[model samples]
Target: MDEALWAFGRASGVVALVLFTASIVLGIITRSGRLLPGLPRFSVTLVHRNVSLVGSVFILLHVGSLLLDSYAKLNVTDIVVPFIGSYKPFWQGLGTVAVDLLIAIIVTSLLRQRLGVKVFRAVHWFSYAMWPIAMVHAIGNGTDGTSSWFLLLAAVCTLAVGTALIWRLSSRFVESARLRQESV
Candidate 1:
């Protein structure tokens, strides 16, 4: 029973990470208005939203399984509160913080219509922080942290997000520069 729960928790965590990475990449692509071979921007946006929702579900499963697994020894508070878990407090705390940030992002997104674009965007930016925190938490605390497969997965995720972030930021900078030149 314990082994099953442990395997489920690990698998769910990895899946969540992959989905989160895909969501971020898709979001960047959507923002850039880049259409894939057969996918339009709107389709990309839809996929991003769906992927994010699925990732969140996986995250919930990962946490729930870990909590239920006696081997992990995680309590409800450990899931909700940061830095207070009996096991691997620092790493677990990072995970908790990431989860809290994700929850905030999800809530703000759902309330985006009522909250207005400015507020929604401000909250959404927290996802940038949340992703790295999650990555670190997984690598530092995961049972398979040192495994070659896990490391490869983490590396791929990091590279994808990093490249997208650079592209997004550079494009914004170019746009701003062009605007400045036009104003001048």
Candidate 2:
């Protein structure tokens, strides 16, 4: 039973990482108004939202399974509060912090209309922090973190998100430059 729980925890954690990477990349692409052939902007936006929801579900499963696993010995407090766990406290705490940030982002998005766009946008920016924290936690705390497969997966995810971010930033820079040229 303990082994099963451990395996489930590891699998769920990996799945959550993959899904989160996809969500981040999709979000950047959506912001840039980039779409695959035959897909509209709204479709990209919908996919980004849905991917985030699914990634959150996987993250919950990852936390739950690890908490239940006797080998991990994670208490509920460890899952919520940062830096107090018996196990690899620093890395685990980073994961906890990322989870907290995700919760804030999700709640703010849900209340976006009431809170207004500026508030939601400000909260959403935390995702940039959350993703790298989560990645570091995974690489630092994961048992298979040094394995070839996990390294490849991490590399691919990093490359995809990095490319999207570069594209998004460069496009924005070009737009600002164009505006400045016209103004001048």
Instruction: Tell me, by TM-score, which candidate is best.
Output: 1
In candidate 2, what residue range of length 10 has the lowest lDDT sum?
173-182
Q: Model 1, 1-184: lDDT tens per residue?
A: 9999999999999999999999888877765667767886569779989999999999999999999999999998998899999889999999999999999999998998898777887898898999999999999899997799999999999999999899888845233343345333
lDDT of each: 0.89, 0.87
- Give lDDT: candidate 2, residue 4: 96
Estimate the Cα RMSD of every predicted model relative to the unseen true structure: 3.9, 4.1
Q: How far in Å is the alpha carbon of 89 misplaced in model 2?
A: 0.6
- Give one clash count per candidate, in the order shown: 0, 0
Measured against the true structure, the TM-scores of the candidates, in listed sequence, are: 0.91, 0.91
